[model samples]
Target: MALLITKRCINCDMCEPECPNQAISMGDEIYQIDADRCTECVGHYDTPTCQQVCPIDNTIIIDPQHIEAREALWEKFVVMHHPV
Candidate 1:
């Protein structure tokens, strides 16, 4: 499943670079994760990078939208931001 960055994000910029898929971004008042692009480090890392880097516990909620499988996630990612 993908990860969701909640309001607890301190804008520390730590989790932003930790995301392997580059899904995390600085939002208007907090950090946001691109659900479609977020693989939860499935095809990349051993664990979720954002969750690992985020100092604030529970701030980054994994599977918040409940896309548990990687195949489904890849499809969504491809469709969301593809080179057309």
Candidate 2:
């Protein structure tokens, strides 16, 4: 599943640089995750890098609207990084 930056985000600017998929970007008020590019770091890390780097607990959570299984996420990752 993709991740969502909640209102609790402090805009610390930590997550944007840590996202291996480059999915996080500055939004109007906080960082936003591009669901199409977000694979929860499946191809890069064991856990979501944004979640790991976020200072505020629960600031980054699963995107309920873009819910996806692990296999789906892996496929997305492969398509994005492998591109073969």
**Would you estimate the TM-scores of all the predictions?**
0.78, 0.96
Residues 4-77 of candidate 2 have per-residue lDDT tens digits of 99999999999999998999999988889999999999988888988998989999999999999999999998
Question: Which residue pairs come into collision in candidate 1?
Answer: none
Candidate 2's TM-score reads 0.96
The CA lDDT at 62 in model 1 is 72
Worst 10 residues of 1 by lDDT: 75-84
Q: Estimate, for each residue in 1-84, the C-alpha lDDT of model 1 and write its tens digit.
A: 878888878888999887767888888899888876887776566778788888889998875556667778666656655745
Off by over 4 Å in 1: 74-84
Which ten residues in a row are the worst by lDDT in model 2? Answer: 43-52
